[model samples]
Target: MTVCAYLALGSNMGDRAEQLRQAIHKLNRRDGIRVIRISPVYETEPVGFVDQEAFLNMVIAVESDLAPEKLLETALAVEQELGRVRTVRWGPRTIDIDLLLYGDKMLQLEHLTIPHPSMTERAFVLVPLRDVWEGGALPVLNRPVDEYLRLLPQENKGVQKWGTIGWETGFDHSES
Candidate 1:
């Protein structure tokens, strides 16, 4: 069976746009994954790691035969390959990939959760998510993604579309 999943991509450590593009490529190249759609990249201010640079972010839609756990593992691997180091919570990094949703599955375990815990709270996640999912409903929330976006406070700081990039694009760092 194919599982529709949403992934949020972010980078601030190096070539932000290139890191996102490379991460997308790595995701599509995974054995059981297929890229369906990708939102235009957005530039957003740093959230948690306030001392670091802002992040270039995007969201990807994918149909995957891989299970949630395997998918999470693959995302972690991509982060590692991009030179992500877990030095601090939300610290600056070369790449950061998050599994935002996995079909309608409501997962709650030690390391994973569907409809990511903080997805709705951030404009970075909500804006790109709405771009790709506009009228689509979130698996766990059972409400349209746009509705959730509407409910949030309108304080999007520096989140705007830079341009479009794809899976086939070579991973070259594009300065943000």
Candidate 2:
């Protein structure tokens, strides 16, 4: 059975948009994963460690047969393949892939947490999340993604709509 999973993508190093594009392609290319709906990119100021470059962020919903852990592995693999170096938490990155939701399942493991800890507080995550979340109420939140978005003024965080990466049909492999 295929389950829908939502993942957030961000980049602030190298070709930020290109990194996001490649990550989406790689995720879709993985077995048991299909790229479904993708949200427009949002440019936001860096959170936590605030000394980095601004980030271009977006969200994507995928249909996956892989378990949550396996899905996370796939995401990590994409990040690694994209030259993501994890030297600092919330620091500048070539690419960042975060699994925000897995169907309606809730998980709290050592390394992975479903509903992604503190996602609701981050506008960079929630702005794009509102774009792709279609369910009546956000699984466990009991409110729509937009409602959560409204609660927090993403504008205060410098979150704004950026670009709509045109990759619906397929990626132009010649360019990265």
Candidates in order have lDDT scores of: 0.83, 0.87
> Whole-model lDDT for model 1 versus the true structure?
0.83
- Where in model 2 is the C-alpha error above 4 Å? 153-157, 169-176
Task: List model 1 lDDT by residue over 100-170, tens digit each.
Answer: 99988989989998879999888889788887774477767878777777787776444777777654343
Most accurate candidate by lDDT: 2
TM-score of each: 0.89, 0.92
Give the Å shift of residue 42 in candidate 2: 0.6
The window of 10 residues in a row where model 2 has the poorest summed lDDT is: 167-176
Q: What is the lDDT of residue 101 in candidate 1?
A: 90
